[model samples]
Structures are given as structure tokens and as C-alpha cells.
Target: MTDNPLSQAEYDAVTDAAAHWCMRLHANDCTVEERLAFEQWHDAHPLHAFEYEYEYEAMLEIWDVAGDLPRPETVAPMVRAKPATPWRTFGIAAAVCAMALPLAAYSGWNLGWLPDSYQHFEANDNVRQVTLSDGSQVELNLGSELTFSNYKDQRRITLKKGEAFFSVSHDTRHPFIVKAAEGRIRVTGTKFNVWMYEDQVRVNLIEGSVLVSSNDAVAGDGLRLEPAMQASYRRGDFTPRISQTYDNDNSLAWRSGKLVLDDLALTDALPLINRYLSKPVMVADNSTGSIRIGGIYNIKELNNLVASLPKVLPVYLTRNKDGNPVLNSIPQQAPKS
Candidate 1:
């Protein structure tokens, strides 16, 4: 035990730094250099190192109790310590499954976010985890625009762009509905993630279930998803269908700030990247529509996504006047020795 006991000043400093890093990471605009800067800041001080380790252990302890952020588990403390507990853990269960009576404690803030400053985004980009008044939790992905309507009868969200994982509070009358790009997804129970673009939509179900349908089209043709399931819809397509199944881990892992793309195309990739950025990444030619790129990237940064190609294909990535990223292919040079 390096130091099981921590003073208030030390504890505040640690959680503050940890919270900044937490918020910075959620902003997801951090460059490699920026990430390195944080690492240096964390390691520079002995107190910082100890607090980070302890806070991490505290984070893991919290996760161990809750399983995840969206669907937090109830974790009541077995014992109280001299210092105040900084974490709150909750309990959640899968949809349509019998749940055991949880020996769970319900305390601490789920994520150490200021209530007054909780929902606002500052500097660079922000991914906010918002807990609605009704009790449903939403982790708004980077560069995401989330507006919640807390009405006496209904709760609604309009995701302008980017992605979000919703652990909807089970309110039958409220019926949480998300409106995005000519489609609407309604859920009563369980947890799911929805990724939206100008022309396409993707939904992945981790635990529980959800009903996905096109608001622009017939609801009858909409698809339903269970745990480990995914669905996608593109404009001009005939119907929506269940296309893939990702293990809950792979499906909901982005909550930890990773991008999960499954053999998506450059054309498809463009809008996804643009969702997290202010400036659009325009692909000059539509002929390259089928050029494919895959793998989970930290939607937090654009560098990894730009690294998808090399050799033979000429690709250019640069920041423009408006500070948006533009990606297009350059004419390949003739082979030279």
C-alpha cells in the first residue's frame, strides 16, 4: 500500500487533475502531443502519481461494481472510510432477463462532473456523459451535439451528428426517442449505441434491447435488436436489416473512447469523421466510394484515421482555414527507384 490514506488537499488535487484528463479525453480533440503532455503532467509529481494510481483503482473499483457507465450497477459500501467516498456505483440488468437481488450500494457521482458545468462543452471537442433528470444516462461521443427535453410527458434527444450510447431510463410513457438524419430510434429498456451520418445510420446493442426504424419511412419495416446485435440503414436502400453482431464488449467499447468501424468505406468513413469535427472532410470523387478502411480508432483523434492508407494510393490530409480536416487522393507518382 503506497499510501492508503490521503489528505483532502492531495485528494482534491488528484481528482481535479484526473477530472481534467477525463474531460480532456472526452473532448477527444487531443493530439498525440497533447496526450503526451498529460502523461508528463501526471508523472511529474509524486503526489500526482499516487493520486492517479489511487483514482484509477477507485475507477476500477467503481467499474467492478457497475459493469459500465451507461448501465451502472448499484454498489452500496460495505464500510465507510474516514474520508468521503468519491465514486458512486449503481446496478443494472439485461433486458428480458431475470435479475438477482443486487447487494448494491447507490452512492457517489457516476462521473465527477460539476452539476452546474456538467452538460456544457468547453474548448476543442467534448464528449459528455449526461444523466437526465429521469434517470436515463447518455454518453455523448466526441463533437456530439446533444439537447435533451425534459417534459412532464416525454423526454427526447436530437443528435445533430456524431454518436451516443443511451442507457434509457425505463419510462413507458416518456418513451425515449432519438431523432437523427431522417430516422428515429425508440427504446423502452436496455442499452444501445447509435451512430448517425447524413446518409447512413448504425445501431449496436450491447445489453438489453431496442427498436430501430426510419422516421422517414414505414415503422413496420424497422428492425429490432438484442444483445450483441447491430443494424445499419443507408439512403435509397429498400429496407433496414440486421447486418452484424458484435460481442457486447466490442459493441459498447467506444464508451471508453475507441472508434469501432467494421470494414467501412472511405466514403462512409468521411461522414463519420466529420461528425466529430467542425469542418467537413470532403472526399473529392465519388468513384472512390468503395475504397475500404477498418479497425477501431480513438474517435478522439483524427491522426489514426488518416493513417489507414499508404503506398500507391496518394492521399492528402491537411487543416484548412476553418480548421476542419479535408481528405482526398492525390495523383500517384510514377514508380521511381
Candidate 2:
């Protein structure tokens, strides 16, 4: 309803609130209830209603900017940050233009590198199990961010951010490679997970070993992580530590909407909780943030998780200003020590 929008200031206010509501709605974890409430709230005032619709429409346009382009129906969501500029242009240009991305990138790739086409995957909010031209299966985890790049000889899977698991169907010709946070993971055939957030990068080998090195090969030295081994790499160095290992039980359960908090304290579980929901989660105090908790909870069912938390911690979950979630853990006063 830009026809008669709200005052500039009013429009900004409503639109900003609406954007936040969108995130809240997303984190609502399920159903259109939040969206419905938002609609009602937006329509409460003429100006607010108009601004809401205008912003909503803008969102649709930005999303459909790649109008009618063939894209994977569901993909692991990426952080709500800007996608590469180059990909956006390609999206608009390729829509319905008899577009055919190299299907080989989805099939059997051999000794050679991935083509430039794979560099830009149009993904969304679901795990993308991609078969490289070499027959390697690369499963991109939820919200895991990555890009594709094609070199003359080696196919590259660049974990721009987030995480992914590779269950490579071995091919001797082409060595499977994963790139993340200025580090490189290379393996011939095996299962492994690469998690990257900012400079925190880790590689967990599930089945086979991978030769990992800092992307800055000139200055960075990585190492081989054998099965059940994990390493944390930052600033181009791997903090030598045996990675956590799991068997028959669900590994990477997040992909299945399950959060396995293994004997994790409330404090320890905070990070995973924050990651699952779109909205932010924080502890009110550092002391509370350090509490450990353990148990498994379905990612979509937060109430169960919340109700169970109290039994496991000396804290309460409270809302902060601006509606962010904060944990407030209290303990019995110690007798005059």
C-alpha cells in the first residue's frame, strides 16, 4: 500500500517491527499463527498496515527476484545475510532461459575440478545432498553456507560459513575437497563434518582421514584428522584435540530436527539453542551461561526443552528488553562460608 504510505518515520517504525516479527515468526518454529498475528497488528492502523504490506511486498520481490528460476524446493537455510552479488544476477538471468546447470555437478565428477557453474548453488532452507561430478556426495547442513568454484583440475566445495558433511563415494582420480574459513579439507573417500563459524572451524572425521590445511597454505599448516578425531582451527592453526565421536546414535541429528545435548549443562547447551532458532538466545549472567546440561530434544518442540531445563539447572528463562531470550539461573545462598 505504497499508494498512501505512513509518514517516513512511522513507516520506518512499522516496517522495522514487521521485519523483526518476520524473524519471530520464523523462530516460532512452526505454523502461521505468528504471521497471522502480525497481519492483524499491521492492519490495526492505516499507516502501519500500509507500511507492513509495502515491506512484505518488497520481501516477496526480493525473494522472487529470481522469479521462476528453477531452485531446490527446500534447502538448509542460510543466515539472513546477502548472497553473493554474482549469484543474484545469474538467478535473474537464468530464470526460464532454458537454464541447465551442469547436471554433472549433481552426478559423477572425476579427477577434474568442478566447473564454474557449481560455484554458485541456488540453495534454500533444506539440506542439499549434492553429488559432485566425481560421484562424491556433499550434504550441506541446515543453514550451512557454501559456494562453488571451478578450477581447471580440482573441484572445490567452499564452505563460506556454517557446516556440511561429506560422505564421499570414492574416486581416485579426483580428490574430494572442502574449503572453509581459509582452511582446506581434502580426502579421497570418507565421511566427515566441517563446521565453520567466523574463525572457529572444526573438522570431524566419521569414517576416514582427511588432510586439512589452512587455506593460507603459505603460512598455515593443517593436519590429517583420522576417524573419530576432531580439530579446531583458528587464524590458520588447528588446536589439536580429539574430536567427539558417535556411532549408531544419530550424529548430526540437527539435520533431523533433533538437538542431542549430551550431558550438556544449560550453559553448554546455550550455543546449540541459539543456533537452532532464528532469534537470539543469551544468558543473563556469565555464571548462568556456564551451567552444563544434557539430554535430547526435538528442535521444533522448544517448550519441552524449556520445561525440562529447570529440572536440570538453577535458572529460569526470561525475556530481555526487545524480547530477546535470556536465561536467569539462581542458586541457594551459600551458608556463611
Candidate 3:
């Protein structure tokens, strides 16, 4: 392996070429002519071999994490055919790369030629904090899933589910966009919160400004929100209802491990509360879902809250056959029997 470092452009070209060769050589439909061509390319220069080895190693790592790999016998011939070299000792790298090619494409590797890279993040049981390449910050609430891609001219985030808070770094050249469900929140730099439910998306702006628009919305045809403002729209709705003023403290209570349910329906509130629980709370029927409640509760004391639900609301908590907590409307007493 050559120890010399190539320039950025040169390194990118080599890696791009190596990635293409890696894919072509391992393809099920790869031809004899293509295999010969790959060998020639690999031996053309030491840098080519070095980069190919690196790319092969990366693909193997991805497959290792995924716990799926091609059989060693299927890939042994490719390595044994090559002349003995420091970079050609691995017998399974090419097979692993070929097996994971589809995943690589889905993950935005695109044969290593795409300028933008993609990342996925999830907060399964606790909040997660992430810093982007451009210095922007994100905080994902429990059970939230986020996908990110940074292009030359844009920083995009897809909120696949649940909620997240963002503190974006100022960058006029590259707009920051957050996509949740069918809606998009666009800004140059700002602090905001986004919550994505099954049928709705809510945006709360804490600093700077943002444009809340739908996927099919026309230019300048979206709602603009300033500090202390909020907006929400259901899936497929292009127009969002904007609230000029909102309760900042209540809106952001989750960051402090608290939930502030101010007149929110039980159905609407359970989703937020269940994010902190191992077993989610479910409504027994639609009648129980319609009961509105208000209170501030610590997320850590979820069991206690479940026990006290009957005291504050006209609903009682029971356990299902599987031991999952279920909320049901209280049975009214008979006037005469």
C-alpha cells in the first residue's frame, strides 16, 4: 500500500472509480470482460489498489453491522486471481460489497460519487443531541427518528416520526429545511421545535423566523412564523393555522423531563407521555379518548401518574391481559335499581 496522500480532487476521483469497479466486479451479471477490465484497473497504479481496498473495507464494515454477508467461497476466487499484494489478501470484501450494494444505494453512497452524504439517527429511550457539519444542533426526543443530508446549497432534515428541537447555525447561502410528514419548515438560521404525529405536524419557533409550507406549496405561499409563534397543519393540508403567541415554557417542557398537558385530550396527550414509558398507554374506547385533562407531570414518575389518572379525570386506568395499561371511561352509577 502506498503511504502518499493525494489531493482532495485526486482522492475523490480514485475513490469514485474504485467504488464503481467494486460494484461492477461483484455484480451477479458481471461479465468476463468486466472482470478482466477490473484487474487491469486495479494494477494500473498503487493508489487505485489502495483506494479500492479502503472502499472494500468500508462495505464490509457496513455488512458486518447489518449482520448479513456473502459466503466466503463465492468471493475467494476474486482475491486469489489477483497477484499477491498487501491490498488483495481479503477474500470476502468484494462479496460483501456486492451483497450490500443495494443498501449502499439506498443509503446515498451512490457508488461513492454523490457529493452529499446521508445519516440516520433515532432516540429510542432517551433524548439524543447531534451537531451537524455546519455547526447546527439538534435534540431528538424519545422515540424520534431523524434523517439528515447536507448538500452544497442546503441542509435538509427529515423528521420521520416523533419530535425534535433545533438550533441552526446562521448560513445564508445554505438554507436549513426540516421536513415532517407533508410539511416543510424553511429557515436560514433559527431555534425551533417540530412535532410529527400520525396525521399532523406542528412547528414552534423560539428565535428568528421560519416558513411553514407543504410539499406541494407554491413559492411564498406558506405561513411565516416569528419568535414565540406556532403553526400546525394536518397531513395533505397546504395551509397551516398560525398562532402569533404560544406558551414557550409549556411547549418546551419535555426538554426538562416534564410533560405539561394543558387542556389536551387524553388521546392527544398519551402519545407524548407514552414516549417515556416502556409499555405505552392505550385508550379502551373512543369515549375515553375524548376526555380532556390538564396537568404538569414528571416523565420519570409515569407509574404514579397512571395510578392517579382516575382522581383528576373522569377516567380509570386498568391493565390489559398482556399487562399493558389501558384507560377507560368511568362507569356512571344508576339513579334507581
Candidate 4:
């Protein structure tokens, strides 16, 4: 009975319809009329029935690989005597549960219910822009990922990795909170940039005020921040370094596809540059790595900078056995008296 194969467009249409039917059945107040309508729609065409079955089976396969997917508390009982409710509805529900598992295992944040409960946003290799449920806007930098979990008490975000710029919506009743490995940031409403990686977390405020606190500290006792200010926390440190000033444009330069560094150390800057390149750039010695350099770099065109670094600094590039480039320091010349 499942002989007919559907085209991609036809399959998508059928699956979409099946999904809607699944939601209606799962709705708490699903009426008998809706159930009857669904029965009619399913019986209207053989292709419809087949597509629904295909979707259901696919969902089961996903469930096999992805554990503990969420589902509605209850679904309305099937009204028709013969050919009960399509398993497609169950599969779609299960697929929704498994949607976030593929990346969760590796990302270090795995609460099985997050895929169903939280809103997820990610930018892979290139910058991405998204609007939050509360009308707030977010720009995710390359390779960054974050999830939003909003509740009646507060709006919380778990920044998994990389950096993100948030233009928060004003909601005094429910304050906004961002939690990273480094610490937690609390604000009523604000515009800010957060970079989280390894054991380091940096929060740069462009506008609005935020309270920065250690992961274990109470929000009331966190450090209060103002515009153009930055707070950085290192792992194992008792407190975060706050009240530092930063150039707003420099902090947010990634939005314009540039890496603008103001005399940042080569060692420190390579990490940022490595985020954009397919291969990593490394220094051979402390001297080469410690050289302070400042320039606006085109992240997309890194080859030019890597080729020209030797001329400006007392450093030279050499390839390893694997042909990966490494920067080594040149002999220090005698200083002029």
C-alpha cells in the first residue's frame, strides 16, 4: 500500500500537514470536531495516509538514536473505528524531542528537556542574526551557540561557546540573566557583548547596566557595571576584574567582519584569529608570542597578514613537518644608546 514515492516538495507538504494534525491532537482542549476533521483529511487521499506513515516511522528511527525526547502530556483519543490515529503524530512529537540531541552531547550542556523547553540559536563559521521571542535581537558570532530559557521570574540564557551581542528588550518585572562558564550577568534590560571560552568570560557593555557576579555569588551582591565598561573573570580567581574601559566599536567589530585589535599581544590575538581560519596559527616562543601588535584585520583574508608579519615584527614563519606554519622570534638586535 506504500508503493507511491513522494517528491521533496510533496513530502514536505504532507509532513507539514501531519505535524499540524499531531499538534491539534496533542492540544489539551482538542475537540471531537477537530478529531473528526483530521480523520476526514487522512482518509481523503492514499498519498496522505502513506506520507503520514513515513513520517511516523522516521520519527521512531530518530528516537532510537536520541534518548528521552519530550512529548505532550496527552493526545485526544482517535474517534474513527478502523485505521486508528496515524503513528505519524507520535513520531513528529518524538522528533521534536530529539531535535537538540545531536549537538548536546558535545556542547557540555545537556538537559534532555532543553530542546523542547528552550529556544536555541547558533552561528557556524559565519555570523548569524536572530530575533528572540521577547522582540530582543541577537547577533551570534562565528562558531557561537546559546540557548534561551524564559520563565515568569526571569529570562535566562546559557551561552555555550564563543561570543554573542544581545540587544535586550526592556522587561522590568522579569530581569534578564546570562550564565556562562566564567560567571553570570544580570540586567533589567541592556545592550552587551559576551565572550565565553575555556575558563575565561568577558562581558562588555555597550549600553545599559549589568551586574556581574561569580557563578556561585548572589545576584544582589554582584558587581554593577556601566556603559563602555568591561568585566573579565578567570577560572579559579576569587573575583572578576571590573571597571575597565573599552572602545565600543573595537569590541563590536566582528559585526562588520573585521578584527580590530589595539596593541593586543600576538599570543592573545592568535586565538581570535584562529576562530576564523581553517587551520590554527601558533607561535614557537614566548618572545614571538609576546609581541604587541595593533591593526584592523580582514578575517576572511588572513593569508595576507600571515605572509606579511615577518616584515613588521622581529619574527619569522617556519613550517613544521606537517607543513603547518609556526611563528618564531628573530634574534633581538642591540638597542641604540
Candidate 5:
């Protein structure tokens, strides 16, 4: 056996190869020929044998941690004595522990034992419905974006922007969580409408109860909404402002291809209205945006609303340099001189 030290790349390659062989030999479907091949490879080089022993010990430790092990009778015989090098053992242990975490995490993720990262979904200028793996249905409004992940203990969803209606399936063991802006809504099974404005989130519960809270982990530090109740909160708020009675139909009218506005500021209304339009409309100044408006307008017929804006409110529609419509407040008439 050569006493020369291995370069970093060479050592990594040998360790990786040894780990691969160790996993292959431990597999239930390992064949006689494969075992012979591993034996031959283990004896081919001193480094190979050393790395194999280290990886085998590492695999055993991993299996112990994972609570899965091959039968004692079926265990393969060790091909060589473990080296008594203290530094080498320490290095191997550290590397094995580091490797074990990611390996175990990947396996757990595949087996549905761990939470998955976000899987993004978006509806740009059109409404769409998505069914999750847990059989929950989400109806995304126009210009909306959402992300979701199903963990073993809980199913989580984040409303990144715009609005969505959730029809969650019943699963008492796994609580359903919806996060929007600074708030979190937790439920077991429920149908609800969640609207995410620029800096606020509105949740209107149609059926089932939901606990809306801030990011804090304090127990009972939130508001619980019964069916037909609505709650809203701005970013950074500790608790949502509850509305015991709300216009549920108006809140969900966007789902039926309509935009319902009731004394809502033009600033707030433009964002909802622009979701249906190919070209977005912008206000010239705050005065145009501050105008209070109310209407039930067909989303498909947005042009009608643009034409009627001047007649209903003190605003005029004009085109910007980019050809997008801009709403400007009409100048008040001067008194007779």
C-alpha cells in the first residue's frame, strides 16, 4: 500500500465511490456478482479499503439514526480491520455527519416525512384553479400568485399576491395553514377567500373556523373567525381587525367575473380593476386616487367602466406616453370674474 497522501479532489472521488459501493452492497437487491465486484474494488487500493471502512461505519450510523437496518443475518462481513488513525477517524466522522444530514433530509422529503419548499403558482391576467396533492382546491384570481407545500404534519400555503379562494379538504391530523403578508390563518378544514393587497390581507371565512394571527408564536394571540366572518390586518400588525358581519357575496364577486366596489377609494379600486385589463390604468395624482367609488362592473367589459369614469367621478381618462390609460382628476371650474 502506498503511504502517499491523497489530493483533496482524489480523496473526495474515492470517498464518494466508497459511499456508493457501501449503499449498493446494503441494498436488498444486491447480487452475488455485485458483491464480488465490490470485494475486488475494495482490495484494489489501500485508500479504497480505508474509505470503504469509513463509509460503511458512516452508513451504519445513518441507518441507526434513521431506524432502518438490514437483518443481522444478512449483514455483509467486514473485509478489513479499521485503521487506528485518530485524526482520520475524526475527519471521517465529521464528514459522515455532514453528509448524513442532507442524505437523511432528501430521503425524508421523498418519503413525505418532511416539509417541501415552495412550489409556485401564478395566474397572470386570467383566473385558474389548481388542485394540490392533498386534494385541496385553490381558485386563483386574475394577476394572482400563490405558493404551497404539503408537510407530514401540516399543509401550508402562501398567498404571494392578489386573491384566492381555498376549498380545503378535511384532515384533522394535518392542520391547513395559509400565510399572507404578515398574517397566518390556521384551520383543519375550511373554505375561505383571501385577498392580499399591497400591504394588507383580508380573509373572509365562508365555512369552518380559522385562527388569524401575526407571525408571533404566542398561543391564543389571534382572532378566531366563525363562518361568514371576515378579518383584515396590515403588515406588522399583531392581530387582525375582525368584521363580525361582512358582505360575503361582494367579497367573492371576482370569482364570478365581476368587480364589486362599495365606497372603496379609487386608489384601492384601480389595483383590482387593472387585474382584468391588458393595459393597466394609473392615476395622475393622489386626488384622482382618493375619489370614492362604488359599482358592480363586468370584468370582461372593462372599457365600459373606463368610459363611465368621467361621468360618475371627477376624473378624466387620458393616455400616457406608453399608451396605458391614466386617470386624472378634472380641474374645478373658476367662479365668474
Candidate 6:
């Protein structure tokens, strides 16, 4: 064992780093460069390797308690240490004591453990409001789904679909994170709205600040976003863009039962509009999808917007057999006889 005496803060940082390394090692596709980086990190400090080994042993102990499961064949064999009293062996006594009876069963040294229970919020036709365990409030927009899980050191939220506005409470010790689509948003205290439309992810900062990054935490320096700014990333794109002057209020208009589109393409705007109703508005083809539309219309006046489409552009609107709106381009009219 290493002989370094660590301060509480230093210990937490080392363990967090160890957790990240352990997670990387478990990945089946961990590459040569990653292994080399791990080696370099381990060699940088004696305590680094020691923390990793301790974490690995704790994981193995969990597997042993789970059943006599075999260890991952890739890792080098560790000399078995005699087990001590239950939690003391892993140095997780403080964490175990912090958990309630039910939560203690689910809490583990692994990085991915969720507490005993999480709050699941899903919205259909109407928007929903949720207050988390840490006093953070979320305005879940229509057709959205998310799960909120709290741990001793972090508040984690996974947005499965659609959009939500987050009002995060201040907790410097515990960061607030939202995982959506292909990236994540990390914050200490902030107000922001995140929208996931298919493979695209957009985060608009209303106040305070946040760090936005791709799912790969080690890949690149994450983007820092401040008030009145927006960051957008799409799948397969090399990099995301941060807009200094995006009209964020337009996106949040849904909270007031209004639909606001500001020169947005028909293809992009349709999905957001569709979220307000059960029956959707579909574009007939790619040609009609390129038309730019800008307006502020009440969601309750969807029929009026559909009726007025032909007046604004060369498009024909019709309903499918299921009573869903289908938009198509208007064919040329013949000369009058």
C-alpha cells in the first residue's frame, strides 16, 4: 500500500480519478492510447496506482458477494488480502453510514450506482413541473421524459426525450448534471433549457453558467456557456457551435402555451409543434421541408396556422386518413380558359 496521507479533498479527487480510470478499463473498446494514458497517470503519483488498486479490489469484492463470478481476464491478478469487517475493508464506511436503510443496499463503490429510488417525470400533452430532492425545479415540456437520481456527491438527470427547463439550486460540493442525447451539461447553480430533437442536442442558458461536453469526458476541453447563450451539437458533427445571440425566449414560449418559430426551417419546426398535440404535422417531402417560417402562434390555434400556410408560401396542406396534418408543395395551376 502507498504511504501518502491524503487530505479529505485530495482523497475525493483521487478516488474520482480512480473511478474514471476503472470505468475506462471495463470498456471493451478501450484503445492503446487510452491504456498508455492510464499508465502515465498511474506512474505520476504513487497514490494514483494505490487508489486504482483499492477500487479494483472493492469491485472484485462486490462481485464475490454477488456470487463467485470470475474476474475480467484482462486485468492482472491481485494477491488476495484478508477481508476485514464489512465496510472497513473498502474504506466506504462513511458512504454507507450516509445512506438510509434502503439506499445502503443500492449504494456501491461503482461509478454507475443509482440511489435506492429516483424521481421519474414524463409529460404527454401537458408540461410538468418537478421539484428534486435538492430543491432544484424542472419544467418538463410536452412529450418529455427524464429521470432524476441523487447521490452523496452529485445530482444526475438523464433526459430520455424532448426538452426541459432546469432551475438548479446551489451546491458547490455536488455538481448538477443533465445527460441528453450524445452529450451532457454540468453545472453548479444555473438556469438552462435543454432540447433533444432526434440526434441534435441544444442547450440554452437562461442565467448563471454551465459546461457542455460530448459524452467522451476526456476527448476535448468542454464548452463554457453563460447567460443568453446557446450551444448545439448534432450526431456525427466534428464539433458543436456556441451562439452568443440566440433568441432563447422563443424556445421557452411553450411554457406560456405559445409556439414561436423564428425563421426556422419547416422540417425543424414541425417536430416541436407536434409535441403539443397527439396528431402530428408531417412534411410531404424534402422540398417542402426547406421553407423558412417565423411566427408566434398560440398552440390552441394550430388549425388557423394550418389554414394560413397556403397564403404565406406555395404549399398545400391536407390531412392524412388518421386526421394528422400533411404538408405538400402546391402544383402549378393551368392558365384560365
Compare the candidates by TM-score and give the number of the best one. Answer: 3
Candidate 4 lDDT score at position 242: 84
TM-scores for the candidates: 0.52, 0.57, 0.64, 0.63, 0.60, 0.61
Error of 2 at 223 (Å): 0.7
Q: Alpha carbon lDDT of residue 131, candidate 2?
A: 64
- Number of the top lDDT candidate: 5
Worst 10 residues of 3 by lDDT: 76-85
Worst 10 residues of 1 by lDDT: 89-98
* Model 5 CA lDDT for position 219: 59
Prediction-by-prediction clash tally: 11, 28, 0, 0, 0, 0
lDDT of 4 by residue, 97-187 (tens): 4342355443212333322224667898688999877778899988798877565566778788889999999999978889878478898
Tens digit per residue, CA lDDT, model 5, 22-50: 66665557799999998898998988987
Off by over 4 Å in 6: 1-112, 217-221, 246-249, 277-280, 300-312, 318-325, 332-337
Candidate 2, superposed: residue stretches over 4 Å from native? 1-116, 119-126, 214-221, 235-240, 244-250, 302-312, 319-323, 334-337
Residue-level lDDT tens digits of model 2 in 100-154: 2344334212322123244444234666777665566677766666655443455
C-alpha lDDT of candidate 1 relative to the true structure? 0.58
Between candidates 3 and 6, the one scoring higher on TM-score is 3
Q: After superposition, how far is residue 333 of candidate 6 from its true place, in Å?
A: 5.3
Model 1: how far is 284 from its true place, Å? Answer: 3.4
Error of 2 at 326 (Å): 1.9
